[model samples]
Target: MKPHRYEEFRDLHRAGAPLLLPNAWDHASAAALATAGFRAVGTTSLGVAAAAGLPDGTGATRAETVRLARGLSRLDALVSVDIEGGFSECPEEVAALAAELADAGIVGVNIEDGRPDGTLRDLSHQCEILRAVRESVAGGLFVNARTDTYWLPGAGQAPETGERLDAYRRAGADGVFVPGLRDLRIISELTSGLTDTPLNTLHAPEGPSVPELAEAGVRRVSCGSLLFRAALGAAVAAARSLSVSADIPSYAETQALAGAFA
Candidate 1:
């Protein structure tokens, strides 16, 4: 990645309006999003894993994630990869993976604290991994520390969520992410608590709009796995009736979109 690319990606969070980030599953989806004018693109681990017949959040897609990141480096838009639990328990291994992605031209990464067996990692160990990754990137990558407190069963209370986010920020996370959190009051409270650090939340169709989220102090909104799932739904619908009336892209257009990267 270029020296200034990190700053460019970071600036999007502080640009007044919240950044509406769409997660892409592969090269074609990412390229299409870039063509549609999204400045930054993120990868959804669920999409990546499912596309490869692997399970999500099980630390089983490290090779596939790295390969996709390398391929996405060819795009003009900035890319952030989701490396679930950094794919290892050792801090050094996670840091090595972050450095490798940075060398591959990825400007950012989202490392979550959620484990594969439906539990969160130990707080201290999670912070250690964050610190190691921060040191490895040397400010050249935006490390968005993700805590799946609300995402897991029996959604963690706000107190624990705030505590974890604070520890992550102190551990050198450039930004913080909490998926499956939809309460506006709690979102406002968390944002107010972490005044300096940017807060990212997942966008839900039934939830507040982008402007509402920005008003609540969210700096970034991620469309995690929504686009990929919607694509699948559209494909099935078209196959079922052959008259879905969706604006499907032409074969030549898709070919051109994919060929541009070549």
Candidate 2:
């Protein structure tokens, strides 16, 4: 009953070393990331939702998320799906979805408790979702329980962060993700509070670097919508530059950048 992919992903969260998870939006993006030597790739919910003309965190891109997961799972990398709020409030439904993703070759899933209406779900309910998903996957999938206490304005204070993360770990969460947190002191405090679960934080260009986060006890750094947004910005800037400067990137350089995905 050894879950090879699950153990591999779990091992990526090595205490203070931290794994760098660059999220992908589509097949090409994912393939490119894998080609770039990233061992694991996660899907950004915003990238998938916005690309489909739907608002994020509103359960609007369930089908697109699943389709993307199915495709990305085939890549030569461990795939994790960012299933915002589990795409349902019901624990049973969320568990079912997790099972489906596991069957589709997804080794991990990030489930958040923040609602689209600018509110976080009750702690008890979120724990229920985590527990159900853990049971459904049965160690075959890594359930990264995500708490938006710091992301949602007026949600709660720092102490609440530890409480929620501790509760999530007790409810069978393999890892805990707290995005929108950048302070190194606070990151260290939260990470120190967790004994069994690994701490995951969002990556910010203006904030602490990956090395700094690892020093602060973070076990995983997720580049959540950053890569997707950067890719979009790069596309627009490249197009604009072509109109202004005749010195565009050489075809060989572009092909090299595309690597095997090309």
Candidate 3:
């Protein structure tokens, strides 16, 4: 692979088989997924921020996010990073970061409209960021435009979601993503309405499953931060259980379990 190919990503999306993207927070997590046969891996903004001791969705971890992308760039997996709101409102600044990610061998990124302050950026502003990244990245990197309309509760969701996707597509996004859309009817409608554009949807326990989304014409299924969060919860539960039970994973045992990564 040339380490960058939007067409490869586009072809995968057009396959309609549900491209499953596992969001990895670190080198081991990403390398493990690559070794386990995932064709592509994405970095969860939540995971990246939390691991770096920063609040996610706040665009406060740009340096850490870029650093992690640089690390994952060394692996063989196709890489796409979740750059929370492009880490800045300035379109060109986001473009510079996208160029850095591309130089590090990442093939794609998810830039959302939601800001850390819990308010969504304006459509024009979001589109400007998308266009800047597209123009800066030399057409080889996939830019997944993510709208917060579906994720955040508010008025004018349905129309706003569609409008944002349209603007983002016009701004040169390779795919449009709605992270919290779970209704089958809405998913079908979105896919039908945007027939020429690829759709990416986030999947969690309560969301539509991969099979359902594939049937609904969703091209990419992103795990976001669910896997990482689950791992955290499991570790906490295991430790709590050990405090009251005889079962325990010692340091050596934990190392043994992690030997595959080693």
Q: Stretches of candidate 2 above 4 Å error?
A: 243-262
Better of 2 and 3 by lDDT: 2
TM-score of each: 0.97, 0.92, 0.90
Clashes of each: 0, 0, 0
Find the 10 residues in a row with the least total lDDT in model 1: 242-251
TM-score of 1: 0.97
What are the lDDT scores of the predictions, listed in order?
0.93, 0.89, 0.83
**Any idea what lDDT model 2 has?**
0.89
Candidate 1 Cα errors over 4 Å, as ranges: 244-246
lDDT (10s digit) by residue, model 1, range 1-262: 4769999999999625988999999999999999889989999999999999999999999999999999999899999999989999999999999999999999999999989888889999999999999999987999999999999996575888999999999999999999988899999999998978999999999988888889889999999999999999988988998876556667887887776865
Who wins the TM-score comparison? Answer: 1
In candidate 2 the C-alpha lDDT for residue 164 amounts to 93
Query: Candidate 3: misplaced stretches above 4 Å?
Result: 1-4, 243-262
lDDT of 3 by residue, 79-178 (tens): 8999989888899999999988887778899999987667789888888899999899867788899998877657357878888888899999989999
lDDT of 2 by residue, 123-201 (tens): 9999999999888889899999999988988988588888999999999999999999998999889888897689999
